[model samples]
Target: MLLFVIDLLGRTGPFSETLPAGIQAVVAGSAQKAADFHVNPPPAAQCASCHAEHFQDWSRSSHARSLTSEGFLRTFPQYLDFVGIRAREDPQVSMACFNCHAPLLKNADSEIIRRVAAFVVAKDINKLDGFEVGCVACHAEGNGVFSGPIRNPKGNLFHASKFSASYKEASFCATCHTWAPASIPCSDVYSDWKKSRAAKQGTTCQACHMAERVGITAVGLPQRKIRSHIVPGGRSADLLQKAVALHLKAAFRQEHLEVTATVRNLTPHRVPDG
Candidate 1:
């Protein structure tokens, strides 16, 4: 279930507050921005020069391999066929998958996305990583500005930054965690969380996935409470036991046997969500 992974970049709606107004259409594959529109953020490797720790965490994350993973390579074609499109038949037509897998294309022109799609059809990995979901894909906003949940968002102290309350909200993840139509509940974790008890308690997705820890913000930045980027999921064995539970009961009444099984999902969102 590669679709099992949460893809926040595909639907830049959550980050649109900091990006250009047309970025929403660009990332969603709904339309392209005008030629005058432009954006260029540093790559994960460049960001690593300053945010070594954050980069280390992200480099090992599934988010980093959202586009380059072997499983994705195999699954993507099947996914296209399942949806009635064939990459071999029309690579550009199936390019919509890039919306989720290679969201950083939001900064590049649609022509760049088309080229990446051709590379994907050729199974060319060398040219793909640059477009993968990386540091800039999430952190960088319109132009050089960045945004996060930090109070006062003192990014300008070193560079440029913007205060983003959304960084602390579940809706941010839902922008891509959600893909299916209203009638269908495919990869609809956001809707499941909405009706869950956790939403009522105000417990967000980040509360669990991005549990905060005291760590360095940058190479020389002061140590502070920062949300971890090492996002775990249902596939993580330890997390599985912690977030899910099962109960079984069997009863016999009037020479008949009855069995009852109950599952308790401790997380606010649904388990096996996708």
Candidate 2:
């Protein structure tokens, strides 16, 4: 029985391929159930619409592909294997993985929660997605924000009430926009800003990234006002490249053995450091 459970936990693979039957059923079915909670799908707000240019930049950025990505996932199996970590089988653990990758759903039931307990006992839990980060991943309704969608607050027609000053405050992003818990060493751009002079100036993640310079839709849709929904975190490869020019130059000690690394922070708090 112990070996059977171990094997069950070890069944992790690429997100593109079919997951284990049990996991598939739970993820797909539970995701649909969570969708049911939203009676109204968010309508295209100012920035809610797609912005090809911004998205292209963001798509090339690391923030867009935090975990739910192939390259990113490849590192995981090897990293966990190196540390002798096993995969988790508990539903709560599953939910937590989904929380960052597919935050649109939940598996908060007792039975599944117990699975989290069991998985914790086994100490083999793995993350849910590769390139797990996406546009709506962090800029969504969750993240403990009272505003509408975190990214395109204005364009999201469903949450008309969110068009307020509180949504624009930097504190609104402090929730999950920062770092992961101690167990996870994920970047925390939010906290960095909180500690910097920017925080004193009251500059927020949205002000710089999603700030409304002019009323324009992401896709150039003619709206009274467009919220910048092109959540470009990691996809802006060019911008990232430009930002890290100094680091790349510095790393190339001899331009031969130097590994030019370009780092781009999607958030202002940890802009390049992150």
TM-score per prediction, in order, is 0.71, 0.46
Runs off by more than 4 Å, candidate 1: 1-41, 79-92, 153-158, 181-186, 246-262
Q: For this target, which candidate reaches the highest lDDT against the unseen true structure? A: 1
Model 1 lDDT per residue over 1-274, tens place: 0111111222222332343333333333222221112223234654554566787888877788877777777766666666674444554555566666777665466566666666665678865755677776676675447787776754422247777888888888886777766533236678888998989999988887886888887656688987778787766777788777788999998898998999887977666653
What CA root-mean-square deviation does each model show from the true structure?
11.3, 13.4
Q: Give the TM-score of candidate 2.
A: 0.46
lDDT of 2 at 87: 38
Q: Count the backbone clashes (under 3 Å) in each candidate.
A: 0, 33
Per-residue error at 196 for model 2, in Å?
A: 0.7
Give the per-residue Cα lDDT of candidate 2 at 61: 48
